[model samples]
Target: MESVAVVATDRAERYGKQLVGHMSRKISGEWTGQSGYLDFNGRGRVELSAGADALKLELTSDDSETERLEEIVGVHLARFGSKDGMSVAWNRKSSEAGTVQGPYSEEDMKAFAEARKARQKA
Candidate 1:
């Protein structure tokens, strides 16, 4: 599975490390953190970098936990990085036969975006 999320912050690398570190503490898994990359449990990896206007997180995992991983990372980072509001959505990055599928088809992504907007407004 692969996904990405943009967090509203300039401290991308720092937040990335912090987020992974936080997860390691909360979950029973082995994780390693570097400058801008984190590998967790040999099953997943997260990369963080500064975008023009936001922090970007790229996550890839070897299981059917893409959506859940997105939520876990997004919610925690958003809580740490913002107070106004935060929205975390995961997009599928591939459709490989042996890899996990992402919600990236044009139609699905469109529908997902619409739904997210509606949910946020409520």
Candidate 2:
């Protein structure tokens, strides 16, 4: 029960593929399935499955880290054509509670923060 995070400036499809490839190469586990969404403006949710675990990655306009993950998911769909950038979060699951955790790389957080600030200024 661990997690990995990645930051990319590409669309969800491209980003998802990159994530999947990286995880497949780096982690020794069986992949299950991926379920998520992409929008007209190339922002969306990118969730993937590995064995009995689930990884949820989201991109949306809400800037609050305290916001609910589900709300962020909705916002991604609601603000499809908007110019605002998105916030992303990833969580993993295992047999034990709190087994999976994230906020992995500082650079990823910084990139997201910078993008959010730039979007706000625009």
Candidate 3:
């Protein structure tokens, strides 16, 4: 799978869950684990499996499609989690394109914190 596709898929899953949570509050209900696939075509399509009102989220990017997907994920998180539930997870995958790094690590976090404190003291 392409790195772009993989990232888009992961984002779609998270956005779907966030959408569910956001809608659930309106109906006073909870989301039960749903599955879906995201396709980066003209825009993008997040097709969810049966359950939770069977929603399909459509996001389009006229110029920067990848960036659009990222923005959609942000919006979903803001609407549902409101900062509390927002999080990022990294995964390793080897595809025809190449190996892709997902996100930062604990060591990276520690280093970042140390650097921030040092800068603050200076």
Candidate 4:
């Protein structure tokens, strides 16, 4: 399943960087200025985009792992920006439910990384 969330915040970039830095110590994460992604030891992953006024988040994982993955990310972000009142409200795609394949594989992670890079260059 894939879930997307957008949180409006003036400190989008700061919080985005903080998340990357904090999470990268344990998991695999990459930050490329405005956009970045985290690979959760091959179980699932979440991509983050820091815009001028908001932060965009997209998570992909198995149906059984959706709530767990969301909580992992949501809890960290919530604590990081608690003073800013940053809240995460995930918008999930119902059609994709029970359709996610293997949560994510090595090949999928590489593909996503390449796609993000190409988009950034454009």
Best-performing candidate as measured by TM-score: 4
| Model 3 Cα lDDT, one tens digit per residue, 1-83 | 11222233334445566565564453332344565444444454433433332233323334334344544443443334332
Q: Score candidate 1 by TM-score against the native.
A: 0.56
Model 2 / residue 12 / CA error / Å: 0.6
| Per-residue C-alpha lDDT of model 4 across residues 12-118, encoded as one tens digit per residue | 88888898899999999988888898899878899999998999889998888887787778767766776565667777877543212123445655675798799
Better of 1 and 4 by TM-score: 4
Error of 2 at 23 (Å): 1.3
- Which residue segments of model 3 deviate by more than 4 Å? 1-33, 37-41, 47-63, 83-85, 88-122
- Candidate 2, superposed: residue stretches over 4 Å from native: 1-10, 28-87, 90-122
Q: What is every candidate's alpha-carbon RMSD to the true fold?
A: 9.3, 14.1, 10.6, 13.8
Residue range 1-122, candidate 1, lDDT tens digits: 77766666555556666766777675533324433655566667777776555767788886676666666666566555543344445555775322222323456556767988999999
lDDT tens readout by residue for model 2, 1-119: 23222322335444344444443453332223444332213222334322222234433322322234334332332233123243333333323222122223555556657989999
> Candidate 4 — what's its lDDT?
0.78
Each model's lDDT: 0.60, 0.36, 0.41, 0.78
| Candidate 2 C-alpha error for residue 98, in Å | 9.5
Which residue pairs in candidate 3 have backbone atoms (N, alpha carbon, C) closer than 3 angstroms, thus clashing?
Answer: none
- Ten residues in a row with the worst lDDT in model 4? 96-105
Worst 10 residues of 1 by lDDT: 96-105
Angstrom error of the Cα, residue 33, model 2: value is 11
Give me the displacement of residue 13 in model 3, in angstroms.
9.5
lDDT of 1 at 24: 64
